[model samples]
Target: MIKLTKLAVLCSLIALPTQALARDVNDLGVDVQAATSAYIVKNTNPRYPGSYNGSRLEGWALMSYVVDTQGKAKDIEVIMASDTRGSEENAEKYLTNLEFAPATKEGKTVEGGYLFSFEVGKYFNGYSNDKASRGFINEYDEINKLLQAKEFKKAELALAELYKDHTKNTSEQALFAWLKSQYYYHQQQWFGFDEQLSVAYLLRAKLPTDIQYLVAKSALQWYSFKGDFNLAYNAIYALDNIEGKEFSEENKLATIKQIDDLLARTPQINSQINVSKDKLSYLSLSRGSIKIEGASDVSKLQIRCADQVVDLEASELVNYVIDEQSRRCGLLVKSANPAEIKVKQTGYAIVNSKFDAS
Candidate 1:
């Protein structure tokens, strides 16, 4: 006896031309009229079972139906459901009775199939109240409070403890990874932060939409800070593809603007060394390697350390080392042309170098 608690049908007009409409209903082709303007006309709160055995089962059920030219819903079908007991049946029944104002295309009545996703769960402001879920929620809140208070060490300790407990739930695991990433970020552990954030981003499909957006946003910032233009570009691409009724139009637009701004400032890491005459050049290194293209005219590349000087050939790719003792070193590039040589450093700060070799 599961009581349906809240039911909301988010109708998005998938604009398709009349000519593209498939004659066969089984084709899975969308035949919706392009609306000049669309709006949510109804929101229903249905009753659902609160919990089962101290744990709440939360999932989404999708129902597809066509709004006829007469403004009546017809040909209702349950496309997918997480729960088969009654959620799918109820969604189908509810959608069959739902009505909508007829959609229009070029000022003519047209039938359109719309997808309705029913969020089935214990909705306490979009949070579950299941015992296990509640435990995690409470722990997260506690950690969040500590973080807000700038108790970073305490937060880290708490997070470490939380991570020790094994949980098979995908969403919970994602949440934990996200929190760990944030903690590392606050600690200024950039490598750990980036690694953990990547894990969260990959597991985003299992997370809630809001959490997914957060993960993407955080990844964008991390990649930008690391000067990883490629990763930043990928993050923006992910943000662009994220679309749903759960996200507000304003927020989505704001995120797009944020991505644009980040892209504008991101450096193009082509991994090429451009050397000019008598000018010291600096480049950020990735994995202790610098690939210098168009260096055929160069004669010699010399790296000067406190103890020794290592000379390298003017090849397509070069590798250098920066040990703890020789962190700050000098580089001298001698080329046939008055070249400006670029050396990529694989650390936070660029090593001191002098390009005095003529």
Candidate 2:
């Protein structure tokens, strides 16, 4: 799940009412989606050893970045590492040479911050026996490279090959799903939305509870890519519901509140939907306060727009949509002390358009 601060939401609110923030270093970009993308590139790419002539081995780096008002990354910390010895040192060395444009709001850079963790380098697993698996994994490595290089087609092809042949184990399946999700996200493609959702579900369902937080985070990414706001919410809920006996109560509450606040303030508004386009576009209403309760695993919620109600299963993210128009739909939700809704189904519920407000 994404961690947000009261100050961030407050900044988002102030930016919305007084003036529409330009896509500057302060506003954090659309739905915080673009912010995540930009942050991943900033933190991860530096971990890989630049090529001198030999192919680079693939691996993932888990690092946290503190993005300041200038949209520049500062004080990056390594939470975990997949790099061999000295990779962290090398990453730090590379990061020092980097600069970023801080996030801006209302034409001025606000001192807001965001953190991100991403895998860097090629995802190489030392040794394997099956040639098909090896080829597929290599292709997967190539796909990661394409992502790193901003190459989509070749990476997509490589992903297709992996999904088609080598994903039999849980880890392999997880890798395939993550790669596919990232690919579609980069191209703004939704061709495999449902498939990716299913893949995320399958992966999460099989993971142990201890690791559910990580799974929930990954599921949130899948839901966001698939444009399933409800699913994304449910994913956060799942994260919130975890027994935090091992953590301080203050930290647990803080974590849950951050997730809740994000959902409450950031409304996913449909800006454009074309039946022929195969993808959905939305303008995040990321500036209001729509209060929502923290969930406990399998909570249910219903969403209403216009006059229709759609049922969705709540976890951290819920998946629901309005399909009356099928092709195009304009949506908005009023957060002026909205009413609590009940969900009938186990996924997301789409409400009627009349329920939407500007």
Candidate 3:
């Protein structure tokens, strides 16, 4: 069977309009200004099975047909299908009954190909009696049961087999990783737990919206517990990007508060500094003159401001006087301990360069 990548499918869909009313086929092309100008007055979606061996299966199918001069679809064929058990057949049957406005070229009816894509998932309610889908669902249920029963060892074994069986399914892979993370947490295997949870977190986008939030929240908890503030901060950042009705209003407020609390506990960099791509850190002195102190040896320190580069030796306090007209200053510290560099503007602000430690 020929397999079409998602990119290829998208490109084909995009190119359909141009080919639908090719100038060569008809001099005036379709009477409609756009290929999609002809509208479908009546349409029906394919019916999906309620249960595929006691479990719901979801996927997509692509069908193509020609809208004849009579505004009726004919010669429907399935071009591709994620699952062919009944998706292709159902889609073809539905397309045949679909009615569209007749496409006209030069004021006369003309035939044009139409592509229809069907998504079979939660939207359709039915049961599939397919053997492979049923087998996969059963295995998933068995492992979930073991996990719920606290049979960690057995669940681990079952999960391994499940992974081996469905390596091609990204959603299933993420679910397995999440389950393994839970198993490790229950077993007090902290490192293993974090590792597995990290895998699941990175694969969160492949999961559903609700699952994405759950995985991100779990990651935030684990990172916070481990005192890895940087990773925790990142997890909070990821959570902020996820927005959906699945998350309640109260929950959203609580999440915002959690982010604020985390940020408050995080250390700040002294002096407002902007790090450039060239590896030079810049401090804007438009606010006021700032004093910098090196915690470690700073004999090779270089400071550049107003296009003037100055080499300074290690000292208890290095004062750089900035003219009111000077808006920016740059610092390049070369020391065994980069974390020792500190900057302060007396009575104004104290900024710590935690990024130097990273």
Candidate 4:
């Protein structure tokens, strides 16, 4: 969590990538002119959920919806919600009444999809460690002490008890996920650390900007150090997004440089993960191509973008080479035994690749 302190809650719901990959517009087999992006024609503000009134809980909702040729938002999906109770419901209701200007291709209306995130209470600035239940605070403190003392056995028991005993609201879930990630990191459980930290990262969407920044920064440090280039890129991507918006151009470059420096000694990377059952791994790329390969256990590859989601069987990805122009994507692999997906970044950035660990 070094150097990125000022970035507070800009991106919401899910952590963002630098620039998402969009699909090629020419899906039509016949000749079609270049398509123009859809735009918002009208909007309606979402009403506050009644459950959130005066509650210490806070959260955000991320949705993906299709705008038909008539510019109506439909096929709505609540991608993520921090407060599961009503956050998704609010987003769905809001989108049901939303309007848009349909995208066009060759002067004719065409369908398009887009993602949107809405935050509740604009982040839970009212909630803090002091506001947590005494039981949670005591358990957290005791676990911290155990972790600090390298008493892994005790820390493990305490963490388990904390989860089962505590009423985990949004804030507590994020905090507990981070503490669990620390436990994994200390035990040198790289994959566990990555997955748990990612949970912590996403769960903080409605916490606080400063908290979000620290989580993102921690992710960047850990992923780069472990040679998990795919996620490290995501961390830096989200960080750059915040910095680019909040700081001046020069300052943005400086802040990004601080991140780039973290990966300076890293070698070129091909990220992979092993799974014994169903698993999904987010894939990101900025300037190069990627070829995804794995055991036949990979049942499908799903690449989702602002406008579309594409699914491919494992057979289809064997020789696939994703170039600079391709959008960022992810793979959903299923297996009866241990199978893996290898994401090889066969490109380089003089200032891009982070740690040499991969």
Query: Which candidate should be chosen as best, given TM-score against the real structure?
Result: 4
Model 3: CA > 4 A from native: 1-134, 240-244, 248-254, 266-358
Which has the greatest lDDT?
4
Residue 6 of model 2, lDDT score: 11
Distance (Å) between predicted and true CA of 270, model 4? 0.9
- Candidate 1 runs further than 4 Å off: 1-132, 243-358
Task: Kindly list the per-residue Cα lDDT of model 4 for residues 50-159, writing each as its tens digit.
Answer: 43344544444555556677878776544435534566676666666566677665566766545455444422445432234678879998998999999999999889
Q: Is candidate 3 or candidate 4 better by lDDT?
A: 4
Off by over 4 Å in 2: 1-136, 169-171, 190-198, 205-215, 221-230, 237-252, 262-358
Candidate 2 lDDT score relative to the true structure: 0.37
Cα RMSDs, all models = 21.6, 19.7, 20.4, 8.9
lDDT of each: 0.47, 0.37, 0.47, 0.52
The TM-score measured for candidate 2 stands at: 0.33
Candidate 3 local lDDT, residue 324: 32
Compared with the true structure, model 3 gives a TM-score of: 0.37
Q: TM-score: which is higher, 1 or 4?
A: 4
Candidate 2 lDDT for residue 90:
48
